[model samples]
Target: MEINDLTAAESRVWRAFHKGEPVAFGEGEAENPATGSDWGPERTVRASVLRALLLSTPQVDGEIPRLRLSGARVTGQLNLMYAVVDHPLHLRYCHFEESPDFYGSRLRQLNLRSSVLPSVSLASTRIDGPLRMTDCRVRGPVKLAGSQIAGALFMDGADITTSDPSVPVIQLHQSVLSDGFAAPGLRVRGEIRLDGATVGGSVNLEGAELSNPGGNALRAQSLEVRADIRARRLRAEGGVDLRGARIAGRLDLMRSRLSNPGGMALRASSCVIGELWLFRSEPLEGTLHLRRSRIDVLSFEPEVAPGEVLFNNLTYTALTPHEPADRRLPLLERDGDGYVPYAYEQLAAAYRHVGDEGAARRVQLAKQRRHRATLPWLGRVWGHLQDTTVGYGFRPLRAAVWLLSLLAAGSIVYALHHPRPLKAAEAPEFNPVFYTLDLLLPVISFGQEGAFAPTGGYQFLSYALILTGWILATTVIAGVSRSVTRQ
Candidate 1:
């Protein structure tokens, strides 16, 4: 169709395309040119055929085909605004050196699959049906702001590169992205995802969402998304900030790597997250978890809670071997006044692993104090004994108590068996020195030995005292042994 030979309506649509205005279709505006009839099965079939032919053609610069409604090479800038096409809008193998504007237009369908456009602007464009693009290369910025996509938007296996740091490869701001938005394995040299884009439906990016995961070569600010963002492998050189984002369902980022100096923060203060899986991801240089994230309560097992913060199996290199004690960062610190019982337990375990028994015991004591109401008296005693320093201080007192107990027991036994040196009968003539020696001998031996005597009554009394003293000594030793073993 020659530009001047076109009908008035066709020329108007062409002018709108050049002006980059969104195409608005009225009734009967998309009638078939061959039969002069509205769009139907026959028109749809013809459009599909023409679209395939257009895709097959080898596109070159300044090559416009002369066939009516022909598909030819589209170089420089191709504007297709508000123009109604009875068939699919196919732009295959076309390279736009400058920006290609396709604002507001009514078409049966739009398929830019396998096309290369440096900068494509489709602002406020309305598609009655689906928009599919696969393996297309977008070298510059691709803006789809305020566009309404009734059907799905598929951009699978597309390479989008942008040199500007401020502009994203694909921008979808305030647009009604419905049904679904899928871009699996879509590589964006710059930021690939949207900033405040709202997907009225689901988003599937499985095995995609990677931005230089190997080393700290590439650095990004964040992957911001207001909608429920689901991906299997989301990697970034910087942190992943999902603050104030509401995800109605689960947010899965399994096997992802978030490398940032301050670590990552998946903060969802009031957002409803069905389930969040941050398993097997690389550690951030700082804290791995966040402060206020309302994760699913039921999804977590007893070993792990919803609000519980975990930083397990992470290896950190010390900035300096002999760094100042004050400057050294702790593996974990109790900041908030929440459930500190679990925090203390974890701290104790870490200390124990590092062979700091003293610190471990101190942590245990702090835990006891926090939960003393739940523990038994014996548990309290055990806590005290676990402290080596405190236990040492009480050893001497314990020994003294043991010795006193033994002396008391011995006194009782001797009192119960003593026989009055009665009736030394007939006040026998006694040597004062010999009597004194006999008395001193029994006292010095602590009544543990019998006196030498020929009389039967004297020998019996002496043997009883020796037997009682031996029994008392054994009882004392047994008591001491039991006390030490119990501790």
Candidate 2:
């Protein structure tokens, strides 16, 4: 790469690299300088020149060695695969003829801010400094899988689209980032995968649009983040899977619009999050599955409820803006999957933890009602009887009322029609109250029941009193047993 053989634009870049000065050919930082297709020699720089300058160029006295070129059309393949460059490369507002390949390469820093790239391949590459690609427009997939970024990865205001919908537009799966992954205002046409990735700091993706209809919009299963995953105002057209993920801080998806019609809008099964904030968001168009997930605090007061919600085995220690059981019971009832007893138990436990015993009891009563719906016809009949009489053991006062009412009815009927004596010599006085009491008490016996005999309709009345007494005893015993076990 002789100076004489270099083009005018390449010569300037070569000269500026040794002096550690940036050569800018663009009009302004906001607008692209390579907008015209007919870029003359002055605005064109061969990729070979850049490769030579990075690998073999010597630094000037009192100056560092770095390639900083702006607003230039890079020709030829800038293949730096397996190359180790110990200096920073800043090529802002540049247009590339081919995708820049940095696979398995190691660099001090790489900044391609506001550039137009066909694609980018940084798989397995190592960057000691931050890899900034803010406001860049990428036409194809950007691969960063298996890469180890020592600093933050900035992708704010970036617009990335891929021709193939099956592949992810931007993939950082299994990659390790020392700092945060900030991608505010990013727009992608395909999935953005961070599956199995470990971020040392928070992942900020505010105002991002991820559209991969009928597929995964953002797949980060098994991801481990030290801080929060803030995706406020995110618009996703497909399911966002966070299954088995571990977030040390809150998963804030406030005001997000998630839609996947027939599939799940958000699937966070088996996830362990410190706080899950899903409040004030648009009504999810699909199911929200939180099966087997654990959260320390949950704020689930959405503007409009999700179409369906699955909360099987979900455990949360606390709920924000705590409402009574009546208000929150609808969320549990939204579980489209078959009856889940554990979901009700968890809600009741949460209410009890907050020192709301009344709310907790209401939740338990609702659980019984829901369980009754799944029983057989005979079992359901028994369930209805228990519920009506004693509230399935939750309302003990109701049992007292039923018992008093039955005693009064039995006494009135016997007083109106008295029973005859079996033998006049041994018969006691015809006291209606004592006679009814003898028939009502199952284990207790009075001399009146042994001496007197009810005839005709009076006999049927005696039989009815005996049967009613036994039923009341049995139901009371069952209700008391249930309450004791629950306590």
Q: Residue 52: error of model 1 in Å?
A: 20
Clashes of each: 5, 0
Model 2 regions lying over 4 Å from their true place: 33-38, 302-304, 417-459
Question: Which lDDT values do the candidates have, in the order given?
Answer: 0.47, 0.88
Q: Write the per-residue lDDT of candidate 2 for residues 1-487, one digit (tens) a residue.
A: 6899987778888888987788987564965634724566788888888999998887678888888888888988898999999889998988898889999999999999998888999999999999999999999999999999999999999999999998899999999999999999999999999999999999999999999999999999999999999999999999999999999999998898998999989999999999988888898888899999999998877434547889998999998768878988888788888788998989888887899978988998899999999999999998898788788777878867876776687678767877778898888788777777777778787777888888888888789888876766677787678667767
Expressed as tens digits, the lDDT of each residue in 225-321 for candidate 1 is 3355566665555435454455666666656555544433333333345556654544433223433444442121121112223333212111111
Q: Let me know the TM-score candidate 1 reaches against the reference structure.
A: 0.48
Task: Look at candidate 1 and give me any clashing residue pairs.
Answer: 22-103, 22-104, 23-82, 23-104, 23-105
Clashes of 1: 5
